[model samples]
Target: MRVGRALPLAAAGVVALALALTGCTGTGSHADAPSPTQTAWTEAPTDSPAPTPGATAFVSSGTAAQNQPVFDAAIRKVLAKNAEADGNAVVAALKAAGFPMNATQVSQSTTSANLKPGSIMVGVKVGDSCLVGQWGAAVDGYQSTVAPVLGSGGCLIGGIPVVG
Candidate 1:
């Protein structure tokens, strides 16, 4: 009789263990629901102002010579992970999107951390040739900006760090 009782208790314990392992399906650990007040844009704004056609006349805080190496290294990393042409692609995309940027003429700053470790910024000529810079945040093992260049994978155009 004791053996029979022991068998039922063991079976109950196993069932409990299985339920605990599976966890509750509702409100699961990985669930990420956006708040209701947020509105997702279905399309880009048609009335938005067009981008500028050429590079702008803006003075960065630092000089190109001082920060070239850091910029080059950042570009290399971006390209290596992004099909070895992510830098060019990013520049092309910016041009296509009305922010004409020169990827080949990479520059850096001196006397400041314009391209810093945790953040990076890529400059673009916005409307009427005004300079508009797009910044990037370090994501996982990569640096990604909000607006990617042409032929690049995503909207993150550049990862060149700001050294100031």
Candidate 2:
């Protein structure tokens, strides 16, 4: 079942448990049993995976429509919230500045990233090892579109030009 459907049942189970506990007054049946205590578990140590670097292609096995909002929101929120980033916001600014992307497609890859400010990078990949330049090219294309809207000598966050 979908998570939306399962949540209600899960909530009902919690409510039922609370009602059952509220009505219970005696707890003498298990008094003779061993003291209730949990044993601490120690996991066997193993080699840890290396940390993921900047933007990398992550092929999705799911629908892009479902994942697009999350990806777009993340990019938008980051650019909007940060004073140093302006890529995605530039796209929006360009649209507001009278230049809209004619053809745009954003795909989510399985790859994850933890990029520092001013060091963000994205990659388009083919298979496990083949990296594509489409992502970079697209950024440049969008930058060109936004540049005119921003005019000359304006600072940009990502692709969005920041005026004053």
Candidate 3:
């Protein structure tokens, strides 16, 4: 049942990405947006970076597609860490950027062996979709995308989702 729902949401994401890309002319290196796998997050203005830029204020009443860019920007804010970035850091950064804690799910920063996991995932449930991100040495860096929520109506299958 959940898979059934995911297909359409995934299609919508493709459509949105297509539309977003269609308008770009790539005037130069800066004109070309970062590829999904693009790395290098840096130079935050403050300890807690600001929300999405004024031009792209979050669409509180919009679809997951509408919220994705804002969410990605927020994630980038947190990614400014020079070192020691973890799932908990992403959670706090998202929260500081105005994403509610209750709507976010995150993987444990460390494994049962008390070692950092290969990667960490953070997700914010938006409407029927999720804005998901993962980062670490294993992943070679950070990546963000829109995906459907799981059958359990959450993002990560094993993510720690705070309720209340």
Candidate 4:
């Protein structure tokens, strides 16, 4: 009788294990979730303004010296839509727009160990040039300022280190 009971229990355990393993496969409901590459654009407001027509010129050579205005404008557009977004969100937006993830950095300064409501900078290095964007409470408003990397490291103002 014990052997019979053990056989049934073992069969049930095997069945349960098979079902659990099936669920572990990536084909479940979570598979429908937007990937990191798609999340940024999907989360951005539908009415967000389009990048200037000339913005494409900036990425052509991937060098800041080629067309600073277009590059700056493009960065400004991305940051404006994500002014209130966190560092990860900003980096996601940049990556979704074709900026290399390895070349991008997000930094913020805080007084204590806790993150403070301070400035947020997103910098992307392309070739020898860098594009920097800044936005935060310290700034005038939700608008983000974008410019070519300066001597002080245009976008990297605080040396707070890259969080993402």
Query: Per-residue lDDT for 26-145 in model 3, tens only?
Result: 546764676575344434224333344442454545555556667766666677753358777677667765676788999999999999998888888877778898888888888888
Stretches of candidate 4 off by over 4 Å are 1-60, 65-82, 109-111, 142-164
Which of the two candidates, 3 or 4, achieves a greater lDDT against the reference?
3
Candidate 4 clashing pairs, residues 3+ apart or interchain: 150-154
| lDDT (tens digit, per residue) of candidate 1 on 35-145 | 567454233344553222332322233223222333334444445566323334545444343332442222232116543433333544222222223233343333422
lDDT of each: 0.38, 0.34, 0.74, 0.58
Error of 2 at 23 (Å): 89
Candidate number with the higher lDDT (2 or 3): 3
Which of 1 and 4 is ahead in lDDT? 4
How many residue pairs clash in all the candidates, one count each?
20, 12, 0, 1
Cα deviation of 76, candidate 4, in Å: 4.8
Clashing pairs in 3: none
Model 4's C-alpha root-mean-square deviation from the true structure amounts to: 16.5
Query: What's each prediction's TM-score?
Result: 0.22, 0.20, 0.62, 0.46
Measured with C-alpha atoms, the lDDT of residue 108 in candidate 3 is 91
Residue-level lDDT for 37 in candidate 1: 73
